[model samples]
Target: MKIQLASSEADIERCYPIVARWREIEKRSQFVRQIQEQQKFGYYFVYLEDDRIEAIAGFHIIQTLARGRVLYLDDWIGETSEYTSGYSRILFDWLMDYAREHSCQSLRLNSSVRNIQAHQFYFKNKMKIEAFQFSISV
Candidate 1:
């Protein structure tokens, strides 16, 4: 019922498996290091209720010429058992409020083309599919 920054090892540990499952990360230590390094550019937060973590969200606030200030979410992984409705909405609402408070003009994220569940949630929250991203690995 509360969202808190996942900074300490203990905090990260609680949500590691959920994130690992979604991202296919193989090592806990590697995830820790990645999160640490990413903190310079973004933040990871955990949703908790009764001392149990139910979701993890990774995001960054950036200034863009196209969108002005935007809240870009890199990940929003929730426990499968609670991912369908209430819990996901709680975190989503919190992020929306966070974006507004930070003076962001938009909240955006890119989900894999295969993640139907996430797309459903996004659409339900009134987000639109505005563009297709093109990229190639170097």
Candidate 2:
């Protein structure tokens, strides 16, 4: 297995399919392109095994009034076979290391309310349920 921060147009291509697969709830090519343009703000890390892309994790360092400097995980998805099988841990550890290197104070993510399995996974990983996130569609 190999993990590396995606850094090129090709890398963005590698990430698109994974994002599309996991986030079929929405489709926004322009948003994806915006994310690609802002690679300096965060990274799309790809996990490759046997020359196949198995997972992708997107993370960013953000400054918040409440959280201060923190690492915000935007999206994380692994092939179903890889879930609960240590691949998530590996990807998280890598993100944590990257956060630490950048002096981030904490790591946070908003798991969709419907993703019960993801909530369990986060709990198992020792992440605390911090607060409720509310959104209103504009």
For candidate 1, which ten residues in a row score worst on lDDT? 43-52
Clashes of 2: 0
Q: How well is each residue in 1-138 modelled by candidate 1, as lDDT tens digits?
A: 578888787777667777888787899888887887888666656555445667878888999898899989988877765558478888888898999999999999997899887788889889999889889999
Off by over 4 Å in 2: 25-34, 40-50
Candidate 2, residues 54-121: lDDT per residue as tens digits? 77877777898988999888878887655586777788888888889989999999888998888887
Which run of 10 residues does model 2 get worst, by summed lDDT? 41-50
The lDDT of each candidate is: 0.80, 0.74
- In lDDT terms, which candidate is top? 1
Residue 135 of candidate 2: its Cα lDDT?
90
lDDT of 1: 0.80
Q: What's the lDDT for candidate 2? A: 0.74
- Model 1 segments more than 4 A misplaced: 81-83
